[model samples]
Target: MKKIVAMVILASVILTTAFAMTGCSDRVVLNVFNWGEYIDESLIDRFEDETGIKVNYKTYDTNETLLAKLEAGGVSYDVVFPSDYAISEMIKRDMLLPIDFGNIPNFIYIDGRFKNREYDPENKYSVPYFWGTIGILYNKNMVDDPVDSWSILWDEKYKGKILMKKDVRDAMGIALKLLGYSMNSTNDSELQEAKELLVSQKDLINGYYGDEIKDMIANGDAALGVTYSGDFMDLYWDESTDFSYIGYGVPREGTNLWFDAMVIPKVSKHKAEAEMFINFMLDPEIAFQNSNEVGYTSPNTEALRRIREESPEVFELPAYWPDDSIVELSEVYVDLGEYKTIYNQIWMEVRIE
Candidate 1:
């Protein structure tokens, strides 16, 4: 199985452009780094056309891989989209360049309810993008019972039919939640218990994966897999897709909340253009287009409203694009500093042993 951790860096190599900027020489190029296939590609062309500023679009599959590239300073990126805990980690490491809200007037449209959080106090470092949960994705046709919670993945009935995420943060987060502990639990004993659970789950798991879960679950190779909310949306192929039977839910104990945000990196040379791209996304029409095409929720409130109204098909599926069920259950994972090593160590044990 492909270890899905080096996601961000690998996608960058495939999608990034090396050519010099053509539209604005004085205005630096804005490098927008994110997970592969996470955004609407048309937005890139639109940004370039509107502002005459070139965008260097790149992608990463895993937050850790993205952070490694940021730390190594391999390529200067003007903007990055990382989740809540990752944004906090980047701020702590000083790898991000602060944004100037003056350049992004669209900041006003973002719901204040989502702002003023611990990761970026005063909304200085990052702007929230798409947010969602990690949960079990099962083929209703393949599974004998309903999959409304994390416990189903551990059921002996589903052994060898389960696919799990390779990342320690999300994989461990699920185990922690199932065991009725915090996804961000700091107690070493609680963590150890989660680790043990993961170790047993690993044996029953078909493979530990991240990006591939979409295809794996969709094609019926796996009945149920641990997956991101948005990934299941992307996997929806047709009526035969079995979404009617498949289910996604946070356990009663809840799962970690993931908030992807737009930020200017310290390596950025195009703060102005970077902010321009962000503002463009907040436009309701663009936000609607982005979410509809990309299979993730739009951070723009107006965009979400417009999307549900304009495109009923996008809203009428088990994907539950508009449902806030998971949002209420999310405890946005925060940076645990050096304790990240603990999760990594335990995850390795679960994978190899």
Candidate 2:
């Protein structure tokens, strides 16, 4: 009788363990890839709690890096946040899957201004995320000058105190714009002129950097740096930083008006779950939280309305919300197709020599 009782208890424990393992394996997991420091992480926790889907979040610094990872194809990403030009290139390659709007009902909250643009004109493949301009962030105490033009970056007096983005298109675009050529210039002569301008300005550049430019500028390590407008606003308004000495500017020659958006990759294994996540992000409340935390202009009309109503000061600052004149001066990026190789080679030469 004692041996039978012990055998029954052992069987019960084995069954319980198997059931637990099966339950764990059955839970849905969603994989997301995005730019570093671009999202509000608490939203991820909230999403997991509400939907019971596990999130595996990762980040990359540049659009080029994001493209490379997707093309290499070892891991599958359910969702990716890429900029305008990159999205255009991916769509041409059929690397992204068309998002099902029926599953993303909250997309109606997206502002119309952000929709039907040159990058994804029909809004077939991507949803607008955050939109901002590329410009200069500077230390007022370190330099006394009208922060108005791209030409100031080349001034010999500020040499070795200026930092530029290591990004290829942005660096090249600045030179292109300064020379009165289109940022998307495809002509060999125009591109070469842009390249030559960058090469000439190399001596004045203290260093080329990425997201780290925020801290470096805030700490007064460098006087001036080229960065996204949203990044500058985030650092400038940070409670920990002394705001009186910092300033941001969009050059008179114009700049890239870039948009970053979320898209489901063709390699996604969980399309439905991905759509659910995208829909959740598009929710007005979630979009507001994300924009407030990240310091970028939200593309959701409702979210922007809430922000403007609650924090009216943001609208007063041109850096956070540029006026119409500035908007008219800005241009969006388009895929360069084969011309990208020439730009890449030019970027390589600029970086190496």
Candidate 3:
């Protein structure tokens, strides 16, 4: 993937010089770092065609991976999609550029519910992209028992057929929830308990994956798997496959309500273009396309209205637009600071064991 991205960047550089030499001096390239399969690829072409800006896209599977790349300072990215807790961590470290809402008039289209939230109380650093919960996606035909709780992941009957997320937060969060604790629990004892549970259940895990969990679950490779609610929605409603029988459920014990938002890194050299890209994304039509392709809930009010008007059935799916009861039980992750180290250590111990 790194090699592929490097080739794209090289080609962009060559093309930029070519365009400039040919009198197209205003052309620009926007470097976007986001989660794998998080965006609608068609939108990139549209953005470039409309704005004369090329997109050099790259992907990371987890927030931790994104943080590591940023901290390493090996790459320069104009825009990044980090979750709520991640955005908070970057802000504290002065790693993000405060967005100028002036340059982004389309910010008004974002739902008020997502604004001034805990991660960016002043709403100066990031803008909500997609938001959803974490849940278990089980194959209805593969599992005979009810799948309402996090404990289902540990059922020995499904040993070697349970897929789990490679993400530390999601994995640990599941164990924390199973033990009746906050997904963001910083208590040492509580964290240790979660760690122990994960380590003990390692044998049952078929693999720890990211977006691939969707295909794995859909193809019957795993009887059950953990994934973002939005990803499950995509697989459940996928028209190319027989996924209509799949089932997804939030644990009765509650789960993480994650929000992946767009932010400009301090190292970004294309702040104006980055903000332009963000503003373009906020356009109702663009937002609608993205939400439709990614199967995530859009935080754009106008986009939601358009979706409701066009495809009321898709808009009404609980997996796409969850009810208040589920929303009430979900908690967004917060910056754990030093506690984050503890979580990483515990996560490492589980993986190694």
Of the candidates shown, which would achieve the greatest lDDT relative to the real structure? 2
The sequence of per-residue lDDT tens digits that candidate 3 reaches over residues 238-336 is 777777768887777888888999999999989999999999999999999988788788999998998888888865555677666767776788878
TM-score per prediction, in order, is: 0.80, 0.82, 0.78
The 0-to-1 C-alpha lDDT of every candidate, in the order given, reads 0.77, 0.89, 0.88
Candidate that scores best on TM-score: 2
Q: Which scores greater on TM-score, model 2 or model 3?
A: 2
Model 2 local distance difference test score: 0.89
Give the Å shift of residue 191 in candidate 3. Answer: 3.2
- Between candidates 1 and 3, name the one with more favorable lDDT: 3
Better of 1 and 2 by lDDT: 2
lDDT of 1 at 51: 81
Q: For candidate 1, write residues 214-291 as lDDT tens digits.
A: 778877898988777776665564445455555554455567656789988888876777788888888778887887
Descending-TM-score candidate ranking: 2, 1, 3
Question: How much does candidate 2 score in TM-score?
Answer: 0.82
Candidate 2 or 1, higher TM-score = 2
Candidate 3: where is the Cα deviation over 4 Å? 1-23, 45-76, 144-146, 154-161, 192-216, 315-318, 345-353
Residue 282's lDDT in candidate 1: 80
Candidate 3 local lDDT, residue 285: 93
